[model samples]
Target: MKNVKWFAVDIDGTITLNGNGMVNLNALSKLRYLARLGYQVVFVTGRSSIEALALAIFGGTTQITIGENGGVISTAPNSHKILADIDKCRKGYEILRCELTHVNEKSVFPRMSEVVVDRTFNLDEGNRVFKEKGQDLILVDSNYAYHINETKINKGFGLDSLMKALDIGYDEIVSIGDSTTDIPMFNRTKYSITFESSTKEVRNTATRVVKGENGDGLINAIDWIMEQKSYCEII
Candidate 1:
């Protein structure tokens, strides 16, 4: 019942958005209020810093974010750190061949490492190849399957690193996420809440599931935690 001192949040579906790049102002206000209430908020997302940083601006300078499935953490611009550098995921010949050969009728297989940085996209060339293979290729700032690319990085590893850095116990924290990728956090956190909009697997593992979708669910969770503070506190 203590005030949720640590909040590990997801970005895409939880905060930033689904199809739009814009954010919900009410959510931002809620987050700011939580901070003033003494919660340490951290963004545990699969996005790369390039994409996630834009979203973090909504939290102002004090916000902390985990990107590239926890391969990167930036407490501030100059404070960027790689929590887990799973470079083995870096594109290689054998991996590319395997990825291409395993491609399904509805899936795009991209040699993401061979990706060409372009004006309009992060990995245009990679997406092109995936498309040529008759797969549905979408360029997300994150690869939830990054472990497929390299066994090193993933949402779980990132969450572990964030907890170590903050010197907070998992038992005192509440984590909220909405993806298969978020499973790692769900598995480890003391309390896990899945948004009503999450995938089936994510919901199945949740300790609690909120009613609203997207940031609305997150805001509800935060309010619930703050309400608990009237009974408990963690020092």
Candidate 2:
């Protein structure tokens, strides 16, 4: 309980297992449980900060979020700060839009720190095109979409920033996620949990692999953490 005080959870494939882009009540309840237990649950996700903020407000009193795979940080519902340079993001996106044939305007979300879009073409080809346009930017594919993001930016970077701002430590946070994008956070934390249904890379990266996937998996992880912490305290 003393060492682990925060949960940096992934959104799409981790918490909302259904891929419906909405956190189910079951997931929300466990988040509330964490809050009640004096734990801060900051969502570290591929979803935009606005989307993450909405989920935070709906879930519990946890008002902070790291969204767009560590591109934006939101302490409140309506306000947030982007981590990436706006000029670089703009230039890369503009170049990519001109170069990539499958850049779907309808599927694209506005640039925050990353340009997100649904998978329409070969992601490998897309990444190649993006790199050709802007060598500084990289394309990351998660459970749902493709993201044009800075090379150095990732979930771990976002979580690290959040920890510094809140005066939390790396060992004090439990990073829970189920995507390739979640790998860096896994390395950043001493404690990382993923689900059975995730990719082999993700499963292997995590310290603990839950028997279930998505919300059920997350809830199970939370219970396990509580038991582990309790045992640690007793000892």
Candidate 3:
């Protein structure tokens, strides 16, 4: 691509095909190719490091992962060094409790870390469900699968940390995601994109909206970006 050194992609609906429970081999290979071409690919997802780690292991280390919306990151999940850790996470959860009087203490951090404090619930009955049983946190939605942590650390903060680590300005980044939490990155970047299956809140904020849903849309968008004369110059 052009001089674009870093690529921030939302993992759930964008990279892995939301709800499929499988990573597209073709798409994963393309991502690995992009990394080989010298672009820093970042998987920005609402999933926690644990969930992201599962996908990264399955994808075979093609790109770095930013998990818990943006709260934590690692080159790979099992690795000890965190790319991002909002120490204020616990504090954020404490605040969430004050604002949301009835929310279960176990589910507050992971859910509120990245986005606004909307609501909370018990693990088994949430809109987004965490796959790991026994963990008090679970996403009750179809869009993301993250174990609830003690803070709302999420994609927005995660992107900012990644940008800081790379010493790149916000204007130099390209953020692509498909949910409400992706809004922060969209608002901060020079170019922001959302998949066709993205929530309305995400699509409305994007500078461009790709045609397909899930991983298909992400692959198409990345291909389109690579075709642009300006983007081609990045590599």
Each model's total of backbone clashes: 3, 0, 23
Query: Between 2 and 3, whose TM-score is larger?
Result: 2
TM-score of each: 0.72, 0.92, 0.68
Clashes of 2: 0
Among all windows of ten consecutive residues in candidate 2, which has the lowest summed lDDT? 102-111
lDDT against the true structure, each candidate:
0.61, 0.80, 0.60
lDDT (Cα, tens digit) per residue for candidate 2, span 72-162: 8999756787888756755766776787666763354455787776677677876687566546877788857777788888998888887
Q: How accurate is candidate 2 locally (lDDT)?
A: 0.80
Residue-wise lDDT of candidate 3 within 30-148, one digit each (tens)? 77777777776677766655666666566654446776656566764455335333344344434445443455443332432332233444434432222222323323232333233
**Judged by TM-score, which candidate is best?**
2
Using lDDT as the measure, what is the rank order of every candidate, best first? 2, 1, 3
lDDT (Cα, 0-100) at 114 in candidate 3: 33
Of candidate 3, the 10-residue stretch with the lowest lDDT total is 127-136
Q: Per-residue lDDT for 95 in model 2? A: 72
Give candidate 3's TM-score. 0.68
Give lDDT tens digits, candidate 1, residues 15-66.
6556254566677678777777667777776655545655557565236777
